[model samples]
Target: MQKIRAVVFDAYGTLFDVYSVTARAEQLFPGKGEALALLWRERQIDYTRIRSMAAPDGAYYKPFWALTVDALRYAAERLQLLLDPALEAQLLKEYACLSAFPENLGALKRLRAAGLPLGILSNGNPQMLDISVKSAGMHGLFDHVLSVDAVRMYKTAPEAYALGPKAFGVPAGEILFVSSNGWDACGATWYGYTTFWINRAGHPAERLDVSPSGTGHDMNDLLEFVRTQGAAV
Candidate 1:
């Protein structure tokens, strides 16, 4: 196996947690934080799927913030939260400063110090992704922050897979694509990446047409793999 030059990460869920937004929502909306948050996230991803399958080439990629607001609105209305525009903005802003797992920083530091390039291939809009990387204290850690907004499709889509080579200037084979979703790991794996699935949920693998390079319970196991980044031929 060839050495991996750049490691790319999916921002939300993989690196940053969206639950922080809902945790804050507990103050603004009563009794519906968890359910509202779950619904909001589910609907946000649903919106992306609907938009993607609609003509697939319609130059109609909505930004992450728009989806965030729309999903929030949909969830709020259904749950009867009635969040004002001001409160909504506050929640979105709150999302920008989410903290990451302590292991993320230490582990990434080891990778960088080992001279491997690091980048982000997230589904967030560029601005939102930027805030997330920075707030998580990872601004200087990544060589690039690539978002799906440019391609008008979300991750697990072919368009998102294409961004890896475009942003990193390397062929897919040399890029280690790390994501939390099994389908995403498989997507990039089939797309030719040396993939790693961060199976944080312990969820069983979804039936997929492609196989992944590895699957681990968390980033630390990923670090164990990284320690041998250049060891394999």
Candidate 2:
């Protein structure tokens, strides 16, 4: 494989704990926070995929923030919970400030010290990415915070993956694409980037024919992978 020249990350689950909204969720719904969070996330991703597959030409594109709201509503209905406008607004507000993984800031700093250009390529819309990163106190760590809104397509779409190479001015083979989502890793791999999957939950890998170049449990493992790839970290 080519020497890893830059590292690009998937933001939502990989850097920010999307489930961190559970605290506010539980406060709002009383007893269904965990269930609500899980279902909301699942539906958020499902909506992205459905939109992308339904219109590969960008005709059906919607901002991730909108999809997230729709997912929350769907999840609430599925769980028989009452999500009125105020509760719905509260959850979305919480989501805008999702917490970062405990180890992420340190690991990212180490990689930055190693002189690798780091970036984020997320399905999130630009405003959502900006707010979340700033709220998490990771305001300036990355060289780019890319959003799929540019191409009106989400992850698993080659256009979305292309942003990393374009922004970093590197070939796909020379960039390490990191994502917590197995399907995203597979998509990046298929798009020719060296990929790493952060399997924090120890979930099974996707059944897709492709696989990530490396798999680990956290940002620390991701740092190790970069070190092993001969980066100065």
On TM-score, the leading prediction is 2
The clash count for each model shown is 1, 0
Residues 165-205 of candidate 2 have per-residue lDDT tens digits of 99999999999999998999999999999999999999999
Model 1, span 138-199: residue lDDT tens: 87888888888888788668888889888888998988999887878888898889999998
TM-scores for all predictions: 0.91, 0.96
Flag regions of model 2 displaced more than 4 Å. none
- Could you tell me the lDDT of residue 79 within candidate 1? 86
* Candidate 1 overall lDDT versus native: 0.82
Q: Global lDDT of each model? A: 0.82, 0.93
Best by lDDT: 2
Error of 2 at 233 (Å): 1.0
Residue 220 in candidate 1 has what lDDT?
A: 87
Candidate 1 segments exceeding 4 Å error: 228-233
As a whole number from 0 to 100, the lDDT of residue 95 in candidate 2 is: 94
